[model samples]
Target: MYQVALIEDDIEIAELIKNKLNNIEFLSSIDIYEGPLTYLNSGKKAPIILLDILMPEMNGLNAIPILLEYDPDALIIMHTIKNNSETIFQSIRSGAVGYIDKQSSNIDYTKVFRSILNGGAYLTPNVAYKIVNYFQTKKNQFNSLTDRENQITDKIVEAKSYKDIADELNISINTVRMHIKNIYGKLQINSKYELIKLTKSR
Candidate 1:
């Protein structure tokens, strides 16, 4: 069983997220902290920590290191509305391995939990886009993509679904997915969000 901790100030949002986690099969318990100060003083730890960015007391960005100091193994995932590149990079720099948008229309709980369970990283499409854009401006090292892969990537950045990309490119849906998988492998990213991010950056 996995223990999960949530440090969020918004009562409604906290409850909503808590309920969502409750449905997960592996999660045994959840502890909610309204602020960083309380979370730090509680001496409680969990394998996974879902933290919010804005709070009345100590914000999530500042709390990342402190949580790690308390428990070095804790996997912190920034669960927030802030999708800007700077904040996303700051969270990663501060120690968060994953960033999820609470405001996204579709939040894949299974993918999120599976990523964390596998010790991998998950980034919402918007957040991933910013990171891709940032790196694209710094250095264009991902020039190995094939032309078909590039076409699919462009459609992805435009927020097209697999069916849309396949239809537009006169290819099968499996072909589109295959190109996306190849793109992810070449770019060292996991989700379509990250792929879209990279395409938009280009």
Candidate 2:
């Protein structure tokens, strides 16, 4: 029986996945870890790891490398409710081999298991669509900005203060303020930090 390690913080969700996997046709065993930190300290190894992305202390995305360090051959599949592009892309960037949506009504456990066994990556249809749309939206966001708005955004990325931006652009501080407000609204971001993060992600 193959051993699968499940690192999930939520007891109910963990139990649900455990029960489902337990009933599968393959002869397998599952070990549950409430958090990745605990799993790391335990010094146990499994060939496959079903990791949760939104855990309490150390999230699954952050745990991928550490887990891989311990066992380089482990197949790490991310399990999460997050269907957003950022989370999905970042999880892949962090070295997760597969992604599973816990909220999919038609989530096929058997197919997920089979895909892993066959050396294929598995992603729910919704997740696949989100990843495609996200890249499309990244391109659209560039066209969404006005020329002046784009310039202001560049200044903001350079850590320019409002007054400094105003002086450089030969505009009043109030003009810079209005432009910043418009930029924030168009970008769908709340703070300078988020703005920086969004641009950096692009």
Q: Report lDDT per candidate.
A: 0.85, 0.85
lDDT of 1 by residue, 39-98 (tens): 888888788999998898998898899889989999999999888888998899988989
Writing each residue's lDDT as its tens digit, candidate 2 over 117-143 gives 788888988999998888678667767
lDDT for residue 188 in candidate 2, whole number 0-100: 78
Taking all chains together, each candidate's TM-score versus the true structure is 0.67, 0.69
Give the winner by lDDT: 2
Cα deviation in Å at residue 6, candidate 1? 0.7
Candidate 2 error regions (>4 Å): 141-202
